[model samples]
Target: MTSSYGLTRLVLTDFRNYGSAQLTCDVRPVILTGPNGAGKTNILEAISFLSPGRGLRRAKLSEVTRNNEESKKPEKEQNSSLSWAWGIASTLSTPQGSWDIGTGLEIQEGKERRIVKIGGEILKSQTLLRDYVHVLWVTPQMDRLFQEGAATRRRFLDRLVYGLDSMHVTRVTRYEHYMRERSRLLKYGGADRHWFDALEARMSAEGVAISAARRQFIDHLLQAKAWTLGTFPQAELALAGQIESWLGAYSALETEEKFREVLKASRQQDRESGGVACGPHRSDFTVTYREKNRAAAFCSTGEQKALLISIVFAAARLQNLQGAGVPLMLLDEIVAHFDERRRAALFEEILSLKMQAWMTGTDIGLFTSFNNKVQYFRVENAMVHEKSVLIKM
Candidate 1:
């Protein structure tokens, strides 16, 4: 029993393309199939909000609210139809019982804010979601992950890190805020040396903490049995950064001081470049295809996707083994490009892990093998209907 609990119900209101949709599921992988642009991915994005961050798209709070275009008459009717306070609520069931969880927008002092609630009680911040569930995802847009910017890769790794360290996001947010403040001051008002010292010190402390958590996560990942020899490539992981390297050789305090000095001395240089010289923000998450001894970016397109899946699987395995609980997987258009052999292998791995993954696609045939293994659903115009008999492609 790799997973003992799962999201059994999901309700959407004025979110994305759905006017109102409700789906009830069990402890099984969920497959959502429909034509393109029929709101397949929208369902995954809604489930993502149940966890943390800005869902998968990283869209702003106001952006996810629905805008009704069907109402052509009476402009006021259209305005009334559009609900700015969109919501996502669901029931998470486990061996013990079920917990009520949900999140939505609220207007406080005329400013929109995201709210998270569990068991009918609102949380102070989103970071606390870690205690209840851990969410990890892979989207078709990430097919070119290795070839793209480091920011995307950082986000992928941070989502994995959140399973182990709830405060990682907070630390990252604070560190970036201080770094931005320092940059603005350096360019416009670095005359206050005391302020500079304070910001740099805070950045150094938070940056070092963030880097340390990543290092520990990588170590724990390797130590765990996530590399449970399967069809997926056994990818090697490494952190590439000046700060990450320094932490390897020096103490935490010593490394923080070194980073602080780097920031202090790079003030003029940073101002000219409009970016810090070196920090976790600029660090890279590196992966290698152990079988081919080639970096992920250099591997074939298919191989790159395989490497990403390998990392996600390893993280899920490691999290469960460490008592952190198995994470729910969100795979959007995951099987379209995978070959039959690989596809079968991927499904086997998911079943073995007993992971309750939510997967979406445009073809019903792509998921025939999952006929009995998953809870099937077909999406039509923002509505979802569970299928008892899945027609073969």
Candidate 2:
């Protein structure tokens, strides 16, 4: 039931540091090796956009566009002109067939808007890309997730949930929107009770859905019986918050009702606090090493990294088991932390999964074992060139 689809071709236009680049390769692991700031990670970020959300970096639309280079033209001409926008295009090969997918920024009325197209047809929403391809990523920024505040962990958990449940994003977005509106009303004072009640009801429904989706995704990962990699340790995950704690005591409908009541009762306190104090918004994602039973935040940095990688690998296996399709994996500077033996084991597991994995590294020797098996590329000065010969292997 694993997905046979992978990105067969990728083209970037004015994306990040890349002015124009195109890559054509098989569905094998793609190894990108170059010095830092060579735009290797930027390439992975572009591929991540094929899915949903603001991408791995969580970068803004304006930040993703190529910077406008200083033009020698007159100042008046420069004032009237706009720089070229960015775009990403890829050919996806699925079990059923192959399709062309493209996403880019378009200027409409002096504002840049993201646009998506599938098989030459424009899509109204970026969520539609999920139907064609699912993506999962591990970035260097996420290495310290456990030590960060609850908000970072919550976002990480939500992304894990979103990978399996596409609709989860919609529910989370609606809940956040209503929460903001409720906060504004509270801050301004003289809010109507009826209006407050309506907002609370909608927020409660969406909050319940968000919590349920997170629980379901975690449950599925825990229930999966996939073989664990010898180099990676399993992680025990749990959620902590007022709403998450109540989930066990009440049904979803009951939870929604109870949540609504709680919101109503806390309106005065919320008004004083300038925001809603109790709901899914305050939830936290907690993880521990299964073998040692030690909290992830207390584990050694290396151990914590292993735990995170294990969770992502297990999640991928669960997705394959559920016939949800294998997702493209974006591993940014992930190999530099592992020794030769662990790196080999990681490569073996990736091969077994049969999904296209894009890995980045500064040293080519680190990826010598994958010399002929992977499609090797050297990135320099925002330019990407495929290497035909093995480098010292």
Candidate 3:
């Protein structure tokens, strides 16, 4: 069955470059065409905030609020202070029904806090968002994922896993928190043995959970059927890290115990390094072209881009099979790099998946293949307006 859920209404207030905007459209792909610095990506970033964490840009909470023009005025002449807040509300139509989901930043006690509301009632935590919708995005910045350091790749893998397993976020957050506390204690050089042991025990438990979740995702991806009739090549996924290395030879429990021992043994080294010596925190993900048997990093630039797209497609399919409802896809300037044939294929795949994809590009012609099939919008001067005419391909 095709997905029966998509965003029907979106409203942005004091968000990024847009002071106020509302977009209404059917649950189909949305093509946003605009020049650079026209706030195209800002729209996608707002949608990304619907899910938990730092959103697509990984920006600070304060950074998302639109800078007040009044703030620039002379201190005595300014009419009002900036609200220092932003809001996003959307109507999500699912097979079960429709619900209004809202998220925004509210200043509390001189600090900005993220708030979530469903159908006008406040939600206690952002994690509640996973039950209503799943969001996936690709940005121009991600083009360098393979070429970047291991930390970026790890984050990429975690995001993919988070889509499949919502609890992965909580586990990762807890693991990182414990690791930070442990690192702080190590750095101080006077950590108590008992307290350090307690911290390591907690870290081991959460670390194993994080590693297990990642491994499960990788295993699922590896066994998934390859994409057919696509120009992109399938990727061979692998995990590299101390915890991942032990999973093959030991049960999770055993590995946790071993990890605790390793932590204790490496305390001096960790102290010297000023960080956790080894754990899931240091894990890395490696991708290879299945057919060519070459590492993704070694692939040509265009080939690498294609490979990334292939993996995203594979991930989308996997989520579908796993019964995650239709995921909203945000493709930022993705069409700018693809040829006509590839662009057509990309649109077809999105249609087949029945996903509500938000695509951005400077040239509307790149999305001519989707004319009349998707909502068209023009983003300019920090404002988004629906295009009146649909240009035929």
TM-scores for all predictions: 0.91, 0.91, 0.92
Candidate 2 lDDT for residue 42: 95
Superior by TM-score: candidate 1 or candidate 2? 2
Per-model lDDT: 0.85, 0.84, 0.85
Q: Give the local distance difference test score of model 1.
A: 0.85
Per-residue C-alpha lDDT of model 2 across residues 3-56, encoded as one tens digit per residue: 367888999987888778898877888899888899999999999999877899
The 10-residue segment of model 2 with minimum total lDDT is 70-79
RMSD of each: 2.9, 2.7, 2.8
Model 3 lDDT on a 0 to 1 scale: 0.85
Candidate 2 Cα errors over 4 Å, as ranges: 1-3, 68-84, 188-191, 391-393
TM-score of 2: 0.91
List ranges where model 3 is wrong by over 4 Å: 70-84, 188-192
| Candidate 1 TM-score over all chains jointly | 0.91
Which pairs of residues collide in candidate 3?
none
Backbone clashes in model 2, listed as residue pairs: none
